[model samples]
Target chain A: MELFMPLFIAVVLVFGLIKKVPIFDAFTDGARDGIKTMLSIAPTLVGLIVAVDMLKASGATDMLCGFISPAAKQLGFPEELVPMILLRPVSGGGSTALLTNIYKTCGPDSFAGICASILAGSTETTFYAIAVYYGSVGIKKVRHTLLAALSADFTAAVMAVVCAKLLIKI
Target chain B: MMNLIFAAMIIIAVVCACVTGKGSELAQGVIDGAAESIQLLITMSGMMLLWSGIMEIARRGGFTAIIGRLLSPVLRRLFKKLPKDSKALCCISMNVSANLLGLGNAATPFGISAMKELKKLSPHSDKASDEMVLFVLINTASIQIMPTMVGTLRQIYGSREPFAILPGVWISSVCALAVGLTIAKLFCKNGGS
Candidate 1:
């Protein structure tokens, strides 16, 4: 894994040389574009990060989790995973912290821990991806992106529990 | 839609804070969150620049086109509106390859570049095209061959087999991707614009 990026870079540069491409000029131009992309995405990142932090600090996520616990349980989802599932789409850091907490409390090989691991491993941080990808291009109307992404996340969450039960022994 | 979601988050946070008497924590969170964003940007800039530079060379060397050609059969079904040889298809293939390898940092730059290419082909400058929505949907599903980070974390937490959840991860991810694509296709059919 560590060698992949270095190897990829070496191959690209070697290929560029063989093709007689001005590699240095291309690199600088692309880096300059990267800086502009960063600038364009900054504000959206700030707004999203702050909103997520506020939600965490305000205990609203916990409160929301509590409200959804029964429904989550009814769906055969672990009640303990309610908060992780809720935060997974919105905040990567938040869900990760929750995953560690689950590992601590439930043990890594426990049903809840296995489910949390699968949940974390399988799903992407939807809101962050949506914000960065669309925000960079200044696209205001995302149309069905959020709905589609969240639907996928929801499926991942449910399937995580289902697969954990069906696959893991303990 | 973005406006509503963002506004709702802030409003909910403030309301919850007022009721919970966590104003001080909320205030602190704002400062920390702002600082974290800058910190994240600084960390990402290096990877973004490096990958962007490498990808530029790859593009110039026609490597990205070769990759596009290799992945065209699979990508064509997902992005029917895009032409076979579209630049966006090349970038999207690169991004997908990076994501599958669990190279999250490298994937971001490629995905952003793909988004830009899609933007160029979009009739509406300010709205997402169907292809753009599908691209984002595929990314957010994040199909990976291995859950390396989760495995490492499990190892640190004392799991006997850190990669024991691999089957579960594969099953859930494939299911998620299938569901997300089906929903995206249905939505596009109902009202793409």
Candidate 2:
């Protein structure tokens, strides 16, 4: 994973030099565009961050987790993972913190811990991605993107738990 | 739609906080969340700038186009609406490759650029095109050849074999991507944008 970026850069630079492309100028132009894109998405990012953080901080997440724990358990999801699963699609950072908490409280080898890690690895933060991507492209009407993304997240979560149960002994 | 979700979340949080007597905590959270967002923006800006730069060089050097050509056969099947040699295909190919490699920092710029490129083909710029929705779905459930973030987190938390879930990651991601694409295809009934 660490090698991917450096290797990618080296290959691009070498190829650019070989092709005599104006690598420096192209780089600067793209960089400028990158900053502009970031600026464009800032408002959306801030809104999402505030919403998610407020939800988590208000203890609403914990309340929701408590409400879902029984059903989650009946469905074979580890009770400890309710919070992570809930937050997984909303906020990447919130889910990561929850994953870390699970690992710290329950040993990383535990079923819940393993499942949480896999869940975190497998899904994207759907709402965050939608906001940023659509905002960047100036698309106001997002038709089926949200539905598709959340369905994917649900699939990943279920698969993550099932796979963890099958693969991890503990 | 986005506005509705945001409003619902804020209302839920505020109501829940009042009921739970956590108004002060909620106030602190709002400030902290805003600050964290800025920090995230700065960090992401640096990463995006570097990757956008490198990928631009790749674009100029014909490497991205080469990737686009190689993946064109498969991509054409998925994105029939796009021309075989469309610039959006190049960006999409690069974005998918970056995603598979677990290069999240590098992937966003390409993904954003791909959306922008795809927008140019959309008859209704305000509404997402079929191709755009498909692209977004695939990206949201991107297949991970390397689950770098999870592996690192596991290692940090003292898991002996951080990559033990590699098979699980691959399986779940593939499943998610497959289901996501199928659902997205259902939504794109008109076909070809």
Candidate 3:
């Protein structure tokens, strides 16, 4: 897996050389464009990240998790994973913190810990993706992207627990 | 829509903080969050530049085109709105392949480039087209073949088999992608864009 990247780079560069492409000039041009892309999305990143951080710091995430625990339990979702699932689609840092917290409280091989790992692995930060991708192009009206992404995240969260229970012995 | 969501998040956080007596932490979060984003950008910039450079070479050398052609059978069904030979298709294919390889640092550059091409196809410069929304949906669904970060974290936490949850991860990822695509297609069919 580690060698894939180096090998891919070598192949691309070698291919570029064979094709008579000015690799250095092409690289610099793309890097310049990359800088521009970064600058354009910087404001969006700041706003979204700050909002997510504030939500976490305000203790609302935990409170919401508590509020949703009963319904989540009824739906067969593990109560211990409510917070991680809630934060998964919004904040990567927040969810990772919750995952480690689970590891600390529950052994890493335990159901909750394994479920947390699977959930974290299978879900992307939807809000961050939407913010950066649309923000880069200055797209304001995202329409149904949020709804679809969140639906997928919810599915992934459910499937994580289901798969963990079916696959893991403990 | 985004404006409202952003405003609502800030408003809810402030109100919740005031009610919960977490005003200080909230203030610190706001300050630190902004700084942390910049820190993240700095860390990511190097990879972003390298991947962008590599992608540029690949595109110029016709490698991306080759990939686009190979993936076109699958990509064509997903991005029905795009022309067969659209530049966006090539970039999107590269982005998706990078993601599948778990090269997240490499994926972002290709994704951003794909978004640029999609934007060119958008009738309104500021509104997201259906294809753009679908592309974002695919990315946010977590399609990596291996969850390397999770495995590493599991190993750090002293798991006997760090990658033992691979089956679970794969099942969940496939489910997420399937559901996300179905929902996106349904929404697009209703002319939600």
Candidate 4:
């Protein structure tokens, strides 16, 4: 499965070769368009990065963790994951940092470690994706996109905890 | 709504930083964040260019159409509002394929292009169409077969089998996708009413 990506790329390239497509010219054209798209999206990306950075640096996750850890423990979720839960939806890198920390402290086979790993895999940084994808198109009236995405994130987080406990044998 | 979230995040950051006496850290983080964003953009540009070029080849060689044919049934159900032969659906088909394969970086170009194509069909130019909303929701809740990013991270942290949680990730992601799509469908219907 690890080789799946490289194999997929090879197959695509081989098929393109067989089709007699001008692969180089096509690639450059597409690349140029990608750069143009990047330029158009730069401002929104930068703004989000700064805000997320500031939010992380403010220790807001820690504060939230303090408030929610007890309730989380009561509900069978690991107390250590409160900070991760608070940050996961808003910032992928932040939750990743927390995840690495969890892995380091508890070992990868520990309940907290498996749960954190599963959560990272199963969900996305909802706000970041919404902002980048929707903002790129200049869509302002996001309507229910946020609500639906957040609900998904919420579901993933809960499932991660349950699945890790039930299946991970930790 | 975007503005509100942005402002709220900034305000919360500022107030929390000031109260916690981490003013200097906050100041430093701003610079680091700006630099990271630029770095991320550069990396994204390179990846996007490569994939875009590959996709261009695929499009020219009729490979995208093959992919479209394979994914059309699922895409049709998800984006019923789109015409049967719409280019937007083709773009979406490619995007969903990339996402499922855990090639999210490659998927974004197709996703952005899909939105652009969808935008052309919208009666309200500034507002998202129902199809667009559903697309965004699906993308956010993307179900990955490999979940390679997380697996790689677990490997770095010395897991015996980094992909050991694959089943858990697959099950949870599928669950999230289902929950998200259901909510999106309900919202879409209410909007129609």
Top of the candidates by lDDT:
1
* DockQ for all candidate structures vs. native: 0.46, 0.46, 0.47, 0.47
Tens digits of per-residue lDDT, candidate 4, A9-127, equal 57767877999988788778866766776687678778877776787688765686688878988898987777677678876655655675577668776888888988988888788
lDDT of 3 by residue, A47-101 (tens): 7777767777898867876988899879877777986787688777557556755
Cα lDDT of all candidates, in order?
0.80, 0.79, 0.80, 0.77
For candidate 2, what is the lDDT?
0.79
Q: Which ten residues in a row have the lowest lDDT in candidate 3 chain B?
A: B145-154
TM-score of each: 0.66, 0.68, 0.66, 0.69
**Which candidate gets the maximum DockQ versus the true structure?**
3
After superposition, candidate 2 runs with Cα above 4 Å error: A1-66, B1-70, B191-193
C-alpha RMSD of candidate 4: 6.0
The digit string of per-residue lDDT tens for model 4 on B1-193 reads 5577678878999999999999998998799878976876675566555655665666667764575578789889878778888889888888887776555666889999999999899988788888998899888885776565566556666877777787888888889888998888888845541
Model 1 has a DockQ score of 0.46
Which tens-of-lDDT digit does each residue in A1-170 have in candidate 2? 34554665797799999999998999998778677777876777777777778887898878887888889879999887876777788766556556755786687878998898789888988887788888998999989898888889989999999999987764
Runs in model 4 deviating more than 4 A are A1-67, B1-68, B190-193
Best-to-worst order by TM-score is 4, 2, 3, 1
**Per-residue CA lDDT of candidate 1, range B13-117, in tens?**
999999999999999989987897677667666766665666667667776456556667889888888888788987899888767656566688989999999
What fraction of the correct interface contacts does each predicted structure contain? 0.80, 0.73, 0.81, 0.71
Per-residue alpha-carbon lDDT of model 3 for B118-162, expressed as tens digits? 998888988888899889998898887656557655666677787
